[model samples]
Target: MQWKQNLNHWLHHLPENDPLKIELENYQSDDKLMEDCFYKELEFGTGGMRGIMGPGTNRINLYTVRKAAYGLSQYIKDQGQEAMARGVAISYDTRHLSKEFALEVAKTVGAEGIQVYVFDKYRPTPLLSFAVRHLNTYAGVMITASHNPPEYNGLKMYGEDGAQLPPDAADVIIDYMNEVKTELLIEVAEVKQLEKDRLLTYIGKNEDIAYIHSLDSIKLNDSANNKDLSIVFTALHGTATETVQEAFLAFGFTKVKYVYEQCGPDPNFTTVKSPNPEEADAFTLAIQYGKGNNADIILATDPDADRLGVAVKDEKGEYVLLTGNQIGSIIIHYLLEQKLEAGTLPKNGVVMKTIVTTELARAITGTYGLETMDTLTGFKFIAEKIQEFEQTQDHTFLFGFEESYGFLIDGFVRDKDAVQAAVFIAEAAAYYKAQGKSLFDVLNDLFEEFGYYIEETHSITLEGKDGAEQIERIMESFWSNPPLHIGGIQVVEIEDYMTSIATELPSGMKSPIDLPKANVLKYKLEDDSWICIRPSGTEPKIKFYFGVKGKTAEIARNKLRKLKKLLLQGVHV
Candidate 1:
């Protein structure tokens, strides 16, 4: 078989004493395991490439790390002397091989005569983004899988604007990656020696200070910064403690408590099933501490600290987890209200959200006279919008968020920032406290003002090569033939992002979709409900996103249940 031939090729090239060779020898007797590892190389997906740690082309080991760095090195070289001199900034999280992979990239990039700046230890993803712009580097690398399971790790690449590479630039990097014949044979420069030559610099405290200073500008309610609220924070066994804690202290919230078990750099993420803030089970420890301390709000950040999960007290004094949509809308309401009162709200302001995000954002922004913009499903597209607004100065970029618990408040950092988000949540909680209400009350009032909007995402996991093909087949089926009705609701319109067209169903009136083409299908129901089906760009699964707006919360919940059930049944994977 071709996979066996590739396996033998890798084994032949690896040295006997190498750690990867030793690992391959142990799995030699198992054909399935070896085939899984050797069948294909890990490709850069939505954010970047990610895989389990092991010894093959499909795995995320040192050699694959070197391969990515090699590709990036060549790309920088092609950009000419200025890019080489400006160099790359690299950082890692608490995951296994994170630091090792980061160092490997530095060495590989330096070996190709490009200067490299690397963190001495683990840092959050946003800091890496901030560092890219702060250091005036041409590119940046963050070694993290960002909320994936413990066994998974990956690298995310950032362009000079500090956003993930858009499709055009990613194509160039992939071309360079494909040209690397033998990854294990790539050479690396020595870090210690490179330091002496001033080609390698370790970044930490200074960058942290500068990043913290930038985060401070996200605050809108100076009067609401009183220490009137009790808060509980958890890093979920990752790298958010120091920065998050410092930011809360800066906001004068003296009653903040930390979930000790989940604090600070634990690659295993021992406390939770998954260190994802989007999941309810991931907040067990934080909620427990919150209940014990009678905290007003509970905040949890994922491993790499880019996404934040929140729990707020309801009128009954029970802790309720806030969906990403709920949290984002709360912040938008608070910021918009404050700015409007202060008369600082920009007349031509814009709020950005992913196509699948809650329509509540549009409702809230519209009431305040701010326009809303929708981007394709990724933070990179949102970042690109911010870059455009900054260059054109046509509109003020107020805030951008995704349904997956990622948010960006300030354009200073061209990515989602839990540090900035944590601060805002704290202030928002306090603002409500001053008004003798809770965060839940604020959301309830919003629902009463606007229509009740509910959104949920569900996915089915499939693995290996066959699973990938299955996902594609499922998407293709939806693209070629879409159902006229789902759960007794007639389909009114269909948006085919992959074809960059929107067709009004039954009538068949077509309009061009200005966004980039992507393999995603969205169905707008006759009742104004919607369902979106798209393959998970960063996972071996297919995701189904459901959205429903009703006159009341109970009505919205029931509609969401029916639509979700119907859509999940149709999704084969």
Candidate 2:
């Protein structure tokens, strides 16, 4: 069928209450707007699905949510009665309509005769991961868009082991979702009926208590007490405020202050341009609060509370927001130091990071006779490794982190736990304070020891269907005509994860990559600089990551700037 004809069919068939149809009605004369809305179904990538909130086959709304849930329900039922009995756990952040979508998912799965454990109120993404394992659910679902804007929302699924469904499992779910024909006909058990049947359970405060207790176990250096140290925290108007504040108090920090303006859950994230803690602008209000309170440290979490971001008072008394790489390095150094000192550092201990993360973590890992493994740029692979460790090997999983503000310490939850991270980071701060040092001081010491390793992520947002094709074309262009050098540095090695091949530029020799296949390309430069290109799994954006190491911070910054220019140039063509 012609594209316009297919669109017209959907338009005519769309329900009157459908937001997409309503918007389309207003745009009837605007062919471009109509085409954009009906161009294609929103792409469901490995990170689950995310898009602008609306009603359409190509948007994230009630109908699409129901279809995805129906697909998940079918997948569970196909696994047999035992899987259905085991049930599914569902949670949601404070995004618009997040709770409604989560309840809809529960109803859809309930109609399949599967049990459902739905959180009674807003919760963090990691808690959903924890609930999956704690309740022994067959799968888990979290309705969140992570740090995306207010207009965006998403759905993420996790397998029985509490990790995001691996590619093979995700493919199966995607197939079933695509096969779903009509959203209106999607089967969903009435909420009251499911509740009466005892098939829909509402998770409550007890789970939160258990989760916080698990976070308490993450403290490796309890003997170091620094109750006098002042700190400020912000949830960026999301769901972490109460939990983080409580965790800090539990860790014996008495001077913690919350950013009042952004303390409560605000779906619109009214104050900040973006709810993402990774950006310095997101912490503006928190910084002001920190300065006023004489805070030695500042912490912020994204909307879903899965990723953590921090700032510390430098020697100049200015609040400086640390990059994800810098925070990861500090955490690694602190954890290893305390563990080794306490003689609890495992001989077979391992740490996991993404390919785009700073190599400083690897350098720090080596100092304590520990090993660091690299995965693609997602926390799921790190979660996969934690599961791998529990099932096989004796290697103790000490910590896992990604370059994008996500970190995990204890394996109680498979995904990143900012609540847990906040606890440990507070403990780390207390540990430093006991020695009369600030987190900034500790970070500087780490840089001095591991060389100044700096990393930056540049993302290019391309909207609509054409943007996706452009991203693919750009990636293919790099693969077909690989760079010989970047920023005048020799390309020593190229790792093509899609082909599972790592080729040595100098020797022209290739070796198999030990990790799972991904649509990523990395160029390792001779001067310890690297560039990687990968499309964002949850948004219409392509990311260019650059990491450079130098004897000094200025040199590292310079190298990163040159590499950034080269990367932009490569993507432009």
Candidate 3:
């Protein structure tokens, strides 16, 4: 069928009361808007389905959501009735229709004779992970787009292990979803009937309590009782405020302030241009609150509270946002040092980081005699490492982090938990404050010890179907015509992750990389600098990650700038 015809079919099939359909109807005369909305079905990648919220299969609506739930239900049933009986947990964030989507998933799964544990209100992504494990559910669903714009929404699935479903399982779920021909056939038990049958359970404070208790275990030094230290936290108008606040208080942080404008679960995220904490603008309100309160530290969590961003007063008393790498290094160093001092550091402990993350984490972990492993960019891979350790190795999992503001300190929750990170960061701040040093000062100390390693991430967004094709072409261009030099520095090695081959340039020796195959390429420079390129899994963007290490910060920054320009030139060609 033609794309337009298929789109029309989908639009007409939508329920009359569907808000998305109504919105589309209002734009019926606009050809461009219609084409954009119905160009393709929203791609469900490793992170699950995320797209604009509107009518049509290309958007995130009640129909697409139900189809995903039905597909998940089918997958669980195929795993056997026992797995289905184990059921699924459902949670939602502060996005539009999040609650409605959660209920729809519950009803759809309930119709398959599988139980559903649905949160009664908004919750963080990590809380959903915790709920999956706490309830011993077969699977979990979270309705959130993380830090995406308010126009966007998404659904993520978690395995019984409380991590996002691994690729192998995700493939099966996607296959089942594709098998769904029509949303009309997606079965859904009546909400009332599902409740009567006890298949749909509304979870509330109990799950929150369990999650918070798990967060308390993140505190490394209970004796760092500098309760007078002031701190400010902001949720960026998302779902994290209450849990983060409670966790801080429970951890004995006496002076915690919240940015009033961004504290609540506002779906619109009105105060910030974007809900993502990765951007400095997202922390503006928090900075204001922090400065007004004379706070020593400011922390912000993205919409779903899976990633954390931090700002600390610099030497000049100006609040500066720390890169994700800086924060990860600080936390890893702090946790290891404190644990070792207390004689509680695990002897066979392991720390995991993404391949694109800062090597500073590896440096710190090695100094502490802990093994550091690198995985693909997503936190699921880190979670996979934790499960691997649990099943086979004696390695006690200590910490895991990615360069993209995601960190998982303890394995209690498989994914990153900003709630847990907030507690530990607060404790670390207090500990440092007791020594008359700020986080910024401690970061410099880390650099002094571990060498100056600087990392930067640049993303080029190419929207729509054509942009996706261009991204593929750019990646292929790199693979076919590999660069011999970057920023006039000799290329030492080239790692083609898709082919699992690491080729040493000078010797022409190739070795296999013992990691999952991903569409990523890394170029190692002679000066120990490197650049990596990978298309974003969830967004319409191609990202370049640059890491440069030098004797001084200035040298590293200069090398990084040159390397970035070279990389951009390569991508453009």
Task: Please tell me which predicted candidate would have the highest TM-score against the true structure.
Answer: 1
Where model 3 places Cα greater than 4 Å from the true spot, the runs are none
Off by over 4 Å in 2: 1-3, 18-20, 223-226
RMSD of each: 1.1, 1.5, 1.4
How do these models rank on lDDT, best leading?
1, 3, 2
- Tens digits of per-residue lDDT, candidate 3, 313-349, equal 9989999999989988888988989889999998898
How far off is residue 356 in model 1, in Å?
Answer: 0.7
Task: Please tell me which predicted candidate would have the highest lDDT against the true structure.
Answer: 1
Error of 2 at 303 (Å): 0.4
For every model shown, what is its TM-score relative to the native structure?
0.98, 0.97, 0.97
- Quick one: ranking by TM-score, best first? 1, 3, 2
Tens-place lDDT per residue, model 2, 1-573, is 344764676678877887767776776787765666667777776657888987556788877888888878888989999999999999999999999999999998999899999999988898899999888999999999999999999899999988888888888878998897667568688999999999999997888888878876787866347487777888888888877776776777788888899989899999999999999899999999988888888999999999999999889999998888888888999999988899888999999999999899999999888899988888889988888888898688999998899999899999988988887887888888888899999988988888999999999999887888899999989999999976567999999999999999889999999988889999998898898889888888998898999899899888888889876875673
Candidate 1's C-alpha runs over 4 A off are 223-225
Worst 10 residues of 1 by lDDT: 219-228
Please give the lDDT score for candidate 3: 0.88
> In candidate 1, which residue pairs clash?
none
